[model samples]
Target: MPKPFKIPQSVLVVIYTPAWDVLLIRRTEADPSAPAFWQSVTGSKDTLDEPWEQTAAREVLEETGLDCTPGSALAPHLHDWGLENIYNIYPRWRHRYARGVTHNLERVFGVQVPDGSVVTLNPREHTDYQWLPYDAAADACFSPSNAEAILQLPHYAKQRLGTAA
Candidate 1:
């Protein structure tokens, strides 16, 4: 039996440290010759009805081995940024969704992990990971939406730290 088509909705979770270094992971490309680009943890929901927060937590764990469930070390710091982006799906990846589906709705989130947190990449989905300062990370992202989201990190961080005025 064929796998079900992916939902057009997904979550993008930016994992960062207290010092403002953002975690970016390089995706594993099927074509070895394809250029690699870094992105934050992103994944579609298992089902259309899955809660966005649940999807965010699951993607974080699956992509980076970071547990963000309630009572977990990163749980208290998990935050929903209340931002959303609607953009056209790149042609190369649109096949994952049903035919005629050309757009995606991405919900944004941020999770603050302690400094020096270990990131274990899932080899099947990602090839490597790095923690870069937010500006640099924004420059490294291949997706414009991802880059824009990284650029907004300082605002979210300030709010999370309760320093926003």
Candidate 2:
């Protein structure tokens, strides 16, 4: 049996902390020969109709072994940035989608965790992880979208905490 075609709709989650420390994960060397590039949690929906929040939660767990369920003990907060980016999928990655599916829709989200939170990364998915300040995380991301998402973390963090930015 063939693997299921990937859903075009995906989620980009910027995991951060109230103190503005952002979590960045380094992708294993494979897809690109470039140095291990950093990025936040990102993944596609499991099915065509899955909710973006569910996709965010699942990706967070699968990538970092962190729980973002509605009310988990850690209660790592989650917020949908209410922004979506639509762009043509990279040529090398288009094969994961159905034939002729050249574009993808990515929903942006932010997850807030405590300072110095222990991160258990899935070695198969991420070789290393780092907690950096908002600006550093943004600069470290290799993907434009991922970097942009981190750049917006301060704004969302301020709004979420009832402060003006």
TM-score of each: 0.95, 0.93
Q: How close is candidate 1 to the true structure, as a TM-score?
A: 0.95
Best by lDDT: 1
What is candidate 2's lDDT per residue for 1-165, written digit by digit as tens? 999899899999998887888999998744676766899998999987788888999899889988987688544488899989988898988888999999889999998887777889888878889998999889888888888888888888898889987
At residue 1, give the lDDT of candidate 1. Answer: 95
lDDT of 1 at 137: 94
Model 2 regions more than 4 Å off: 29-33, 74-76
Q: Could you tell me how far off, in angstroms, the CA of residue 8 lies in candidate 1 after the best superposition?
A: 0.6
The Cα RMSD of model 1 versus the native structure comes to: 1.3
Error of 1 at 50 (Å): 0.7
Q: Please give the lDDT score at residue 17 for candidate 1.
A: 87
